[model samples]
Target: METGFPWGSAPSVDLSLWRADAIVLFDWLMSTDLNAVPITHPAQKQALADLLARLEEVGITESTEEEIAAPRKMWQGHGLGGAPIDQSSVTRAQGSMTQDIT
Candidate 1:
């Protein structure tokens, strides 16, 4: 649970406790708070690198560096100018969407 400090709280889960082998960890970061934590120190960097390697060894091509760096697809023509979107949504938008009645 010692994630160097100040982190380990966002998304409110202990990143160090859970199995680095779990794909959910990566997905959680990507979908929850992508910028919540920065892996700058050598320890954090190595931990992440190990996770990626483990993911690769288990045949998970989804977390590849190239794929992660590749441009994300957009919700075309949303007037958002090609903003990025989360990779998954297990629930409703949690906000209202009004109809444009003409």
Candidate 2:
């Protein structure tokens, strides 16, 4: 089985995210201490840095705490399907995931 791509090979993929979601993601990534995450290779670190650069290039930068918090609060109880989500449960899950990574 082919386990991975050859060296220097990069496949392109397109990602589409809502602006609010992208803002939240960019904030999280920017605030994260990647050295604490178990990255296996230097390329992974470079890729993350590259992603941050791309986000900034498109004007996503350090937002005020209020700006970062607003989107999370706004979407807390709603899902893409407009179904109600359990805010507390989601919060707990996010907390645990953050703990696991950090």
Candidate 3:
């Protein structure tokens, strides 16, 4: 399976996100204090800034209340509340699985 990116051939890749998610992400990123974060390289900071600028250019900076609320409702409905997963069951299930070694 060729899962990894072909970095040698591809110079840049496009990113696609739901409009509501993109708006929320942009708002969060805008409110974050980059100075407090321990970013060593200047390019990293510039890259983040560039992302924000692109978002702004695409009208992600301004969103309607419905747009913002829709994603929150969708997430809540899907049970993605940022809760930590219960790993005990996962470990047990993994242990029970038979490995087919060729």
Which candidate leads the pack in lDDT?
Answer: 2
Best by TM-score: 3
lDDT of 2 at 24: 84
Off by over 4 Å in 3: 1-12, 76-81, 84-102
TM-score for each model: 0.28, 0.53, 0.54
- For 1-102, candidate 3 gives per-residue lDDT tens digits of 122333544244467665655776777778888776578897788667767777787777577878667556545533356655456643543344321211
- At residue 53, what lDDT does model 1 achieve? 49
**Which one wins by lDDT: 1 or 2?**
2
Per-residue CA lDDT of model 2 for 1-102, tens digit only, reads 121345755655555554566678789788899787679898898778766766776666755778678778877657888767887866654443220110
Q: Which is superior by TM-score, 1 or 3?
A: 3
Tens digit of per-residue lDDT, candidate 1, span 1-102: 222344544222323221222444454433543234575676776556555544445544555654333222222433366445544431133123221111
Model 2 lDDT vs. the true structure? 0.65
Native-vs-model 3 lDDT?
Answer: 0.61
Model 1: lDDT of residue 86: 48
